[model samples]
Target: MSTARDVPETTGITEPPRATGLTEPPRSAGVTEPPDTPGDPAPAGGVATAGDRARPGDAVRWRRLSRRMLVIHPIQEVVRSAPALIGLLFAGSSQGGHGHIWSLVGLAVMLVVGTLRWFTTTYRVTPQYVQVRKGLIRRRVLTVPRDRIRTVDVTSHVMHRLLGLARVEVGTGRSDKKDGGALKLDALYAPEVDRLREELLHRRPAAATAPSPRRDAAAEPTTPRPTDQPDPLPVPGNEPGTEIELAALRPAWIRYGPFTMSGLVTAGVLAGFVSRIASEGNVDLLRIAPVRQVVDRVGHEALWLQVAGAVAALAVFVAVASTFGYVLAFWRFRLTRTSGGTLHVTRGLITTRATTLEERRLRGIEVSEPLLLRASGGARLIAVATGLRVGHGAQRGGSMLLPPAPREEAVTVATRVLGTSGPVTAELVPHGRAALRRRFTRALAVCGAVTAVLLGLWRWAGLPAWTWQAALLVTVAALPVAADRYRSLGHTIVAGHLVTRWGTLVRRRVALDREGIIGWNIRRSFFQRRAGLATLTATTAAGRQGYSVWDVDLGEALHIADRAIPGLLAPFLLRAGQPSDGMDPDPGTDPIVTSPGA
Candidate 1:
């Protein structure tokens, strides 16, 4: 048994085997046999030998992951230096020669710290699993069991491509919030990463020693099939390639352009703008300029020229920022799939990031069709998962799988990857009377504030405003209530999902699976009692972008309340002792009785 005490000191700490001058012989295409056993050890030479001889349930064979290493984007070197670089540039431009003195100290500290970090970071793989342990002060040790491993993503940024390195992210399901549970190993040799992935995926399943099915002599086939002909098919789960086709590739369009390009650009532009802003002395050209110098250079007669020059400079800054943004966003976008059921995503202009999500962690699917994308017949798909934030932040992360795909292709991918069919159908409950009233009142408050601000501005400018801010506010305030009365929508649970749709101009349709909901709150006010409406807010553990489904009929609220707790609590109680059936009995036509936390 591999116990904690037996864990070798070099387990995840020692450097990996150095790459040998090696190459694999080419093979002609055909169906290939998987390793016979899952625990088959790796060969002494680089090529992994898929296990074919071991019995099922045997101890996992351990083998060092020794293959060519790859590094992530080299630009990460510059990106990591952003803080010190900005400090240096600021010091150089601001304090004449004095700032340069401090800049040297800053640069020295950064170089020492960064170099130490580079040498200390390390990762390793064996037949059983992949392990990563790094961090100078708060050391982190992450071990992902091979079976639990879902996706292995390898990414190469421009720098990585140049240096033949890649960043590898191995995603297990539901990472712990505090620890950043997902496994990350950066700047590894590319070939080594690929070999590790192959080891994870290809090492043969430990062959089961279980007795084979017996056949009567009379029942056996009279003769074997012709040598070139196919053999008799094995039963379900008996054979590997019997039914599985290499999971079809996500369509080409989805893998390229759109989401990939957009994500890269967005991250790039952000990184560039942040780098520039941080580099300068936090100056905003729009608000502050070298006014005295500008006036002196062009002379007092051309006053407009000074203002124009300022505007041009701002424009130039924005233009340069956007270009850098585009370069970063579209740089080296890639999406690939492994033989195992996992999707890999990698791309970055500066600091590279890779993400892998197992098919099982996927709870719900969201397909977004922005106007521009819709017109171009392109759509983006996002998977709502539990625990992990979508990605870097709420805005970009929730998407485990993103490939700009056409509408039909997008829907197809959703079905194949998430087991969802077509678009999720959700009931649209229009904002109820109280809810509408609240929206209208909120709108009115906003309008009132705007009207007051405009009136003050009008006085200050000494100009008569042509628009009636008061009237505009009132009309806007009244629209929600009217929209509710006329076009109000409400929803009901359909096939274990809560469908919510509410909005007039910017319509939104959100569908959340029942299992995806982890928590909820239902509230009603005095005014709501008279209107016969209540608010129900449902919460999901879906990554960091927690979802909320709110404001529906009081009857629906009650039904949700009735179902939520019993359903959630039943499984645990069953594990202890079977509970009575009434715990979550279906509520037939009549509204369910109100309950809290079930």
Candidate 2:
């Protein structure tokens, strides 16, 4: 793993002889003299040449590759709709005296222009950056530094695969905009794709000696990459194919509960159906409008129709649920650790995602439990990484990997990937006596409001008086309180980390590294303070969306704050989180230790 940068400080490794293929033109043509010895290439930031003059072979190679460009997609995309294409033709003919010639001529001109433009578009790799050349009428050149390139993804659709080609997308810390990238090479051969990637990564020997520190840092950074060394290999135990088994799947109910798209679809359909039924006198026998029309045309309304509709809706719901489950759970499902202490993950359905995370990026580990999951001894495990950006408008890039895991399996997996970290400890925040009163009061208010609404509706519309809505209202109001009680969560501060746990029906455990925390806030509304409760928020460099907690006990919260804040804020306060940027330990507190270990 001794990169060009890592050339021994004591004695540098001599460069290998220049490859014959590299010495012909650019370097030989008066730019500079070749190394006295054939070997000994310059290192990063040093000038090197490949002969002076551009060779005929280089010109041929460039032309051959550039000529392979097939089509410019944006033009096709804009005119792909059959109706739109047809309308363009019709509109042209209508404006041009209704002759078919104008329409035909317009289409031919469009195709020819598009093809010519496509032929002009070219993307190339230079040692320092990716060069994009495009435009027929107005030539344009765009360059993206290799290090700024965050993701290099290759994909093939049926047509592309049949053509023995794949599309390569380059994402450069720009997943924010709708079109968040600079260049793409569609219809490139597999070998070419690999070569391009290697070149982009500075993997070629010529590239090896001049690796850009910026690109190296961006690709798989921890701290700032050393300005003068080759990439380092992984520590002994972590290697590819080490086979990190995922945490076991949470219990079936929890696994398939709240977060599953199926649940959302089911709830949505049910709500829609209920609303429609309550509003209209009759329920549609079939959700399919066309089918419903046909059935109604035949004057059919029977018990069977209602049953059929319910069955059809159920089938649709299941189909949607199953598809979504597979997409979110199994999409690109791969687990691998590179030889360089990097955890590589590639997953996603429509837009495949790839992440190469340095082990050092991990902040802590999180195990989540929904109500059903807690009951079933199941938990979803997530690695809380320090440098990951979350949510839209995130200032950085990286994401929390959510893999469903069984409780026991999750613990084991955490031990393996996260390196011997103890459980988080924070002060307990059990709902106090007043919490009970508050919960009941909330429930009563909901019930009273529901009764008033129902009474008013019944009087105005002469609608059937049903006890079900009243029952539903009562349940909705009480559910949260019941859930909160069951969760009876607690938080603790320990050894520079915040550990949080809650959820009676489904228990969840989370740990946040104090070093990774970006900012802290304590909030208490009048009602919350009166109830002797408050919420504590913790932020990280990633962004604001989900980096904080919502509610915890005020007393426990303060104690946890006392232990955690100084360490969390020390980063901003004194540039503390930096590897070499150290700070004095928090004073006047017991060594931060989890309650169990304590």
Candidate 3:
């Protein structure tokens, strides 16, 4: 149970001498000392020989991936497309002729591609850069500087686990491309993957110095170290630096899963899947014994009662399924921050995953509360970091700091991760009443349009009378939602952070570092202009790129922008009478007063 701190630091370990493989050019036939042998000492002026300067292991060397990759490649390719392959076989059998031939052709093509990929791709690790050379026809070499490497991710699926192999992905935090700005080396041995990760992430010590030939070896301590000296206690893998366990999945947290919209989405997908299967097989789902029994039982009830019962049943089923999915995905979840400034998250039941997020790339933290979860005092925390793209595979949960945790816990985790003691989710500045009016008006407009559509259907398309009642109920429900949305809209500047809060169904409060803000965008639509409101967007290199503070007064928006980053917005601000850089505008006067359209 010894931790990293319990492990004694061993000292006086010398680095192995590097091999240079370098030799000085043959000395010109000249006056004095015979051409210096490799062992021979220095020239005049204390000049060191090339052999003295050459560091061994510093050369760029190309290395092919593990040979096992050749076999794993086609197997993985086939596994990834197994569903499609099965579908193709089924369709071919049904069609009875050339379909089977086409399926075979597809398999052949896949095998050929996998073989070519295994043969053509090669990578090299150098002191300055990591280089990948790939392609069969159009040769390409991709070189990423060592300093630019942001994240090193190692992943292993079931097949990889069984074979003791893993995939290594190196990400640079730039997500402008479809590949999520990553260089992938697939199917490396597990140990090799770990070694590569360590080599890439290890920080060289600043005090490391090159070996000096001038130093007297005899002056160094010659006393032989005792071989019997006890080796330092092994550090626990999970205990690196000052590790703090922030949160872990609990059975109670599963209840929050049902409150999310994911349940409804899952239900819809399930319904669609059943319908597709039934249609394809020419089977009547309603004729199924259970379905028929349920239908018959519900048919005796009143129409309204029947609809309500079905809706309730669907909701219950969805909630249960969502809860189960949450459990399956996060059975043993743990979030920890290491002293080395990396956030380590380990989760999953069947396929355990470990993700590392460097603190230096983290720009902010977001606290999200879905309506139902918020009502139950639960919220989720997400990190707004640069390298962890929000939607990439395996990385989808990379930003998630805490999942459906208590609101209080979420706030606490945010504060700790952000390295600030200030109110992480407090002191939010509210929008003016005009924003409320705008929201209410927009809600009413939507309700009115729906009602009009329902009435038109009833009059011209013979729709049922219940449509009118449904429209009325929807309109009534929208009012409170609009009011809630207005209440949720707010922004605040605290301790060099710009916090923007908005949304009703999924309320999000983001605390972004003010220094990370690269630019500001002021947008005003015709309606927003008339309402004297504008949306100010802060653009950064991390997390969604641009986050907006919506529906604030125009003057207030400018003021916030100016205060958030002084010189950036001041040049664009219009002053009274004459344009002056240093002069402060009168507090009573609106400096940029003009028409709403302007």
- The whole-model lDDT of each prediction reads 0.48, 0.49, 0.67
Candidate with better TM-score, 1 vs 3: 3
Backbone clashes in model 3: 1
Q: Clashes in model 3: which pairs?
A: 19-56
Q: Give the per-residue lDDT of model 2 (tens digit) for 1-598.
A: 1101222212322221223343243332221111221121221111223321222111111211222334434345436544445666667666766546655656676777656755775554543455455567665555565545544555555445544555676545442334424356664665555445433432312253454433422332122233223234343531232223332233342343333333445557877977776555355557768977866765566778777887777666765674465455345544444444455555544444445554555677667665555555655555565334444311123343445445566566665565554653235446556555655566666776677777777879675677546655676757675557534656666656676665454465667777767666767777767776667777653222234333555655555665786554333232334322222344434366343553
State each candidate's clash count.
43, 37, 1
TM-score of model 1 vs. true structure: 0.58
Per-model TM-score on C-alpha atoms: 0.58, 0.58, 0.75
List where candidate 3 sits over 4 angstroms from the true fold. 1-58, 64-72, 95-120, 134-140, 202-242, 286-291, 296-301, 391-397, 456-465, 574-598
For candidate 2, what's the RMSD? Answer: 12.5
Top candidate, metric TM-score? 3
Ranking by lDDT: 3, 2, 1
* Residue 215 C-alpha lDDT in model 1: 18
Q: What would the per-residue lDDT of candidate 1 be over residues 318-436, giving only the tens digit for each residue?
A: 54554454345434544444334445455556745555555445556666554445556665566666534565732245253544556666666655554555334433545556666
lDDT of 3 by residue, 1-598 (tens): 1000111112201111224332333231111112222322332211124322453112233445666677778876777777777678878888786667777887887878777787887665544456566678765556565556666766666767777777777767675645425777875777666556544554312122332222311122122223233224423442233446667777777778787656676788988999988997789988899999989999999999998998899989988887776676667887766544567676766555656677777888888888988998999888887766774422253677787877887887888778684537577889989999999999999898999899999999999978977998999999999999999999988888889999998898988888879898878899998888899899987878888999998877877888889877555566443322223443455567454573
